[model samples]
Target: MMSEEKSALTQTERTFGRRQIQAGHALMMLISRAIPHPIGEVWAAVTDPDRLEQYVGRPEGDLRRGGTYELPDGTRGDILRCDPPRMLTLSVQRPGGHSAELELHLTAEDSRTRIDLKYASVRKGFVLIDAASGEWAAGPGWEFFLDSLSDFLNGENPEEPLGIIGWRTFEGEQLGLYQARNAEWEKVKADWDHEHEATPGPS
Candidate 1:
């Protein structure tokens, strides 16, 4: 089990991510982390169904490109692209007929594997309350999952289902970690907005 201080440090380090506006009203969120594992091991941990169930929910259905899959929690999505040991993209459907895109790209950084995740969603008046809060929700959500992935890679067994709020640590509930990460995302969005304001063009 990881100490509370160590877990907090891990969350802080993974909190750094970026938010950007894509074509028109679409928004893109990106987060990347380098795990101290080789590409093959990291790739397998993310793509293998049995391994995935350890941290993320167990996936059901064909995982290959163009196949549809459902998670144990009933979240369904279609695999848009799947390139072994490199990239995986999916179109995840949300409530109210809206959908989001998630893309994962992996690369070998020396002996470690760097995972880059991009999540994009089209802005619907009600779907996303606002850019800042929407990013606050999505950004830390991925950080929580990636942190779970790190825990799994380090041989720590997960005790409960993964989620953004009320995440558990060795000590107990660590909602503070989630809140801190949310703060980071808010800052990222603010910084991006400031930079765009200064430059005056689409970002």
Candidate 2:
């Protein structure tokens, strides 16, 4: 009887694990920072196309249900639903027959606002065969996208490809930042090399 119970537990765990992966590797994090502005101000920062372009990917949809969004290089998607200043649901359909759902939620806090972002991939293995796959992170794209969004909200440009391939290619300001960052890394590498030379290895 005990052995049977163990088997049942294992099966339950496996089921949960599979469900999580199907949800595109679940991740939840909270970021709290003073926006130095009101909730509506931050809301406008995200929903207004002209304002958003300053800090995020250019959007080309009406931002309503049954609307569409054109990403950089002409990649596009339809808006599944949206509730202004509160939530948005998007259906990002890729060329490789993979689609995903992006859920964005915003909540107002006194003098500040909190944004919750969630991404669920409706189609699995889309990255392995899609051209636009490079536009997102290998493991999950939500983190990278949110990081960029935060930086933009703070009035800063993203560091690289602006997405998944940011680390793969360097351009203009990206190249400059890359070079600077690598130069600092090289210094650390040299120090490590010197330390290694002074230490003894396994015999």
Candidate 3:
């Protein structure tokens, strides 16, 4: 499964070199960026609920593994893994909604910090049409939040939470490429699925 699922995608298909790949029926979204700040400083800004509320959303919890947190929109999660200033994992879900996995990893790079963000749907089966839709969701959404986080790190105004509409325009411009990629991804996914003799998972 692992061997055949390696993404045959180019950097051009990625956002800031972020790779989106098919894992069974799952789509693993990966985004990474280097921020100009110490790892601890970067970690603190991200982990602190108050600091986060300034940019993204409200979160309240002890923030340790086994801890539970409430998001501003009432989405909640339990910390599945937590290694402060290094890595954190959570099983997230909304009220009466399907669950998802969110993970954050931090590393030091000279005087700056590198962060990788991943969001994976737990049970929802994924395909290219959905992935194109996801690009419109996770890509611009994270870009907006990261931009806000950057501003907060520099003691600047943490901008408002930008929505998915901006990427709607992006989707319009990339419609042709997205459609082609969707078709290619669908074929690759179908081939991989048949090769593995696996049942399709739930969406």
Q: Judged by lDDT, which candidate is best? A: 1
lDDT of 2: 0.50
* TM-scores of the candidates in the order shown: 0.76, 0.55, 0.62
Summarize candidate 2's per-residue lDDT along 53-163 as a digit string, tens digits: 665556786666777887654456778777787777676565555556566677887876766555555454321213454443322233334445656767777443352
Across residues 1-37, which tens digit of lDDT does each residue of candidate 3 receive?
3331122123213321122223223455555777889
Say which candidate scores most in TM-score.
1
The residue ranges of model 1 lying beyond 4 angstroms of the native Cα positions read 1-25, 95-98, 124-136, 163-173, 197-203
lDDT of 1 by residue, 114-199 (tens): 89888777744312124443432677777777888888989996776573223233223555666666666777777766765655
lDDT of 1 at 44: 91
lDDT of all predictions, in order shown? 0.69, 0.50, 0.61
lDDT of model number 1: 0.69
TM-score of 3: 0.62
